[model samples]
Target: MKQFPTHIVAVDGIVENEKNEILLVKHRDKEIWTIPGGQVEIGENLTDALIREIKEESGIDVTVNKLVCISSNTGTYEGYNGYGIVPTKVMLGFTCSFIGGELSVSDETSDSRWVSKERVLDYITNPNLIERFKAYLKFDGNIQYIEYITKPSYDLKLKIKI
Candidate 1:
């Protein structure tokens, strides 16, 4: 049998409140702010993972409405042996509706709050995340596909509404 490359499956949610503010969270170790989400555990479905992640990280309840976009990127990280290993991550971004829950931070997150769309870019500075935010803003009941590379250089290979 031929060995196939392994890819990480991650999920993120773009949650908006009735006030037209977006939910954002800051990780304990990261400076930039991002939407609430994390990796999917083994045997867990995408939507379930997203719900669990959001609840754990931001103490917010959200309902996954629809998939807004999918992004694939390959990045390098330090391995256990101090060697660099490249891994591909396939992330699904979803549009979620805020259900209920008091906004609070978990151990994984330092702060959580709703930010206006105009100020989102001020908090989210990562190029890739900025692109994803743009897709969320331009989502018109259609799914988008974004392909990019983040290790060697941040290059957006393809972005199209499908």
Candidate 2:
């Protein structure tokens, strides 16, 4: 019998401004546009990891409002392929309130900006990226569970509030 390794835990923040726009960051290395977040280090709390990641990537302060959804990539999303062939990531998504900070980019992020719901598609072309925001739009203040499958397309999303 073999022991399975621990799954990587990640956090994504949906930071919204007074204009009702969401913040997205472009990965400096990957060039992929997604919500600001990263892997949670060992011994770090989920929310704390989220705050640190957002600030590190976007240089902004945010107050975590509520958990939006919990999703498992299960080798479907290639963006988290940093671990090589074995892809397993549990992502905790949260709705955040923008506190204050000047727009700045970190080494991990090439660009950071706010995008309206309608204009999100213009910046993010990845199906997985688009689906993330769409899931948030349908968020009804309930926790959503998502499982992604990339067969025909990246739209294989199953979101259910439990």
Top-TM-score candidate index: 1
Q: Supply the TM-score for candidate 2.
A: 0.85
Per-residue lDDT of model 2, residues 1-162, tens digit only: 998875779999999999999898999887988889889999999999999999999989999988878887665334444644445778888889999997789989899999886787788876665666777888887777887755446545576776
Question: Each candidate: what lDDT?
Answer: 0.89, 0.82
Q: Which window of 10 residues has the lowest lDDT sum in candidate 1?
A: 75-84
Candidate achieving the largest lDDT: 1
Superposed by TM-score, candidate 1 places the C-alpha of residue 45 at a distance from the truth, in angstroms, of 0.3
Provide the clashing-pair count of each candidate structure: 0, 0
Model 2 superposed RMSD (Cα): 2.9
Q: On a 0 to 1 TM-score scale, where does candidate 1 land against the true structure? A: 0.91
Error of 2 at 116 (Å): 2.1
Tens digits of per-residue lDDT for model 1, 1-162: 998988889999999999989999998876669988889999999999999999998889999998988999866555555645647889999989899998999888999999998889999977888999999888898888999987566998898888
lDDT of 2 at 149: 59
